[model samples]
Target: MAGTAGSGSSPLSAGGDGDDSLYPIAVLIDELRNEDVQLRLNSIKKLSTIALALGVERTRTELLPFLTDTIYDEDEVLLALAEQLGNFTGLVGGPDFAHCLLDSVRLLAVEACVSIAQLLSQDDVEVLVMPTLRQAAEDKSWRVRYMVADKFSELQKAVGPKITLNDLIPAFQNLLKDCEAEVRAAAAHKVKELCENLPSEDRETIIMNQILPYIKELVSDTNQHVKTALASVIMGLSTILGKENTIEHLLPLFLAQLKDECPEVRLNIISNLDCVNEVIGIRQLSQSLLPAIVELAEDAKWRVRLAIIEYMPLLAGQLGMEFFDEKLNSLCMAWLVDHVYAIREAATNNLMKLVQKFGTEWAQNTIVPKVLVMANDPNYLHRMTTLFCINALSEACGREITTKQMLPIVLKMAGDQVANVRFNVAKSLQKIGPLLDTDALQGEVKLVLQKLGQDEDMDVKYFAQEAISVLALA
Candidate 1:
């Protein structure tokens, strides 16, 4: 009798003391077929309440089919139906009949189901949530499988270790190799998080035996986005697996990814070098690392180049001055004159960090001269970069080096043809002033700032006067 519902009225309309309370259910059912989209969506959202009033058997026979029929409703309505039905397994005669509501979750509602799976009994989770997840993982639509992959880490935590190992692992491998690039990319992105959440006793074994081969496959995935996604997290496995396994298994994948055709994939590998360096040491990595690093430092993408410059001090400490000068030192200096202002700015800071790492004497011998020579570059921007470099290097290089090696170049640049160079030179003196001895500040720096204070350019003279105030050289 209740099966004849959704025609026009709630089944409770027949006979009940609660008919007055159930009047809203009739209105909700009536609204389910309403032409207005939000009305139908609102009705779908309260579906669990309607099912509760209708009782278990009627919910199964009436509500399930009505939702199935309304699958063609507006996407928002269907999305709401998907969310409501995920929690409906309990309302629809419990776990045995959870299967009748399967299409909603397997297709459009996978995320909500993961949240509800926690509320199920173990038997129900295996019976209801696991099978639904298993099928969703293999669903015909890439979007469904993608939903499963995106939430795979959350699903792993929900199902506990035994189910995750038995059911989710095999499904996960298929997802990582999914024919659609989007699904594979989603799975590739979860590799670190999935490995991280695996049971501690089995975490290493699972990553090495089960997860890694697919990860290796992903490292060369024909899709750049997949490789890029994997590159972002793959270095993380080094910490999870420990040094020996990382050196043996992961190092090769990292080296390969470092040379990946896509700049983002290559950039991702470079950015996370510290992850591997902490585990196996960077000297052992230097052979392959240097070439890929050099290639990325000069990469056509400015962001890629920027990532390498940021990582230079870490690379410098790991490889040490001998190897760094032999290989990477020029790459650091090359960045100072890089066409992109952001790159050049990072390069200037990089010199300061390098001076801190390698000390002032080596900077005098190595970095200081190159920065000083840039003052004479044909491009006025490079001359400005020289002043930027001095500002950064002053704190690290100290008073002797700032006054002796660095200050003369800054003072000389004050007379440059470009007002921008002159203004930055004034800013640089204010920055480096505290680093200079009183004799240098009073005699040389004061005179140069006084000369710059009278410049025709407003910006140059404003900064020149500001520098005099900040340094108290007025």
Candidate 2:
């Protein structure tokens, strides 16, 4: 009954004879009532084609009601409608078409909202679409509210600048403070893109008025995920707000984030330090950022400490040699004795990055001495850390230092009581051996390999034999 022709003459049948015969809108309309889903879908497809052929007036009079009737149908039917709805824009006009489609926004279906946001023109959006969006932005369903926040840009473009400033901004602000964390995150995530497109004066005005006030509350969001989303956008805000403004306003928020209870939020801030550095420069980072880095280096979560290790080179590169000599040097060395082996391993692995940055001369004078002290450390893990450092730094520190100074440490560790230390010694020798220049140094390496090859531990023996074969090939 829904798709049936009314008592009066059918407007759909008035098309050219050849077109009507080929499509037969009446038959397609009848097919819509068929129990078979595929048949109903085919009818919808054919109806879309007929709607296009019917021109604007006929499409409005004849086709739109049938499509609108199926608006509450199955998802596949709704998707098909959403796809074809844009085709009728010229016939019904943008505003009228948008209004017709959005009549069902409160139905809690995402397809209609997504389709309308994507398809409507700039003019239509300002008029009919913006009102629908503003209403949908506060839909009782959080998911429906998410759809509005997610598609804010598309809707923003529809309304254009004038309505965006007055109407859409208020809508976005409400969504930002939405009771749902997801809705709040969705709004926060779009803040950067919103500011990036505006003029400098407008960007400043929005930040000073709209953004800065909300930021402290956002950073302190009870949801860790919401805090993370805000963390990701801080640099963009800092860049837009400029150095002085960022320090005055944004930096306090960043400092507070470093003290957040969630390690992830703290980790997010550390990971984006380079972005922060881009705004505030190394001088500010040295003062504001260094203490946070030092605190995080000893974070209770090993994963958090591992993240700090991963970011060591970034901090070192930004802080420069003076900071490295004064602060980072001691911090990196302390990682050798970290309670977690994985943290120690990462610290050892990352040491070459520091060596490469500061150069071999500085390394030989500064880092190498400390590493040598760790090699003979009472704790076997520190010795293992030393072996890992030697393997990592071999090529970078070059043959002269690796063979003369570093090799003796490897040789001593080869006879270490711990199988882990001995295995790593074989591992370090394999990396360090090929860098040796003189026959005497090669012979000394071979002697250590021979001693390790006979070790009681099978893993050490396996690694030593493997090292022997690798060095022979070299």
Per-candidate TM-score against the hidden true structure? 0.84, 0.84
* Per-candidate local distance difference test: 0.83, 0.74
Residue clash pairs of candidate 1: none
lDDT of 1 by residue, 1-474 (tens): 012234533444444455677787878877777777777878778888899888998887766666565446544665677667767867877666666676543266776667666666667779767767877888887877888899888888877888888999999999999999999999999999999999999888888889888898888889999999999999999999998898889989988998887878887888788888888887777865777788888889898899889889888888889989999988888888888999999998888899999998999999899889988999999888888888888888888888888899898888999999999999999999998889999998999999999999999999999999999987
Assess candidate 2 and give its lDDT.
Answer: 0.74
Top TM-score hit: 1
Q: Which ten residues in a row have the lowest lDDT in candidate 1?
A: 1-10
Q: Quote model 2's TM-score.
A: 0.84
Question: Top model by lDDT, which number?
Answer: 1
lDDT of 2 by residue, 1-474 (tens): 224444233444444455645456667755665667788778766755666566666667556665555434555665565545544455455544655655522334334544465565666656656665666777776866786777777656645666678877787788878899999898878877777765555769876887567767888898987888877777677777789998888888888888888887887788888877888898887787688778888888898889889999888898888877788788788887899989888888778888888789987888787888887788887878888888888888988888778887888777778899999888887887768865844677888888888999999999989998988832
- The positional error of residue 318 in candidate 2, measured at the CA in angstroms, is 0.9
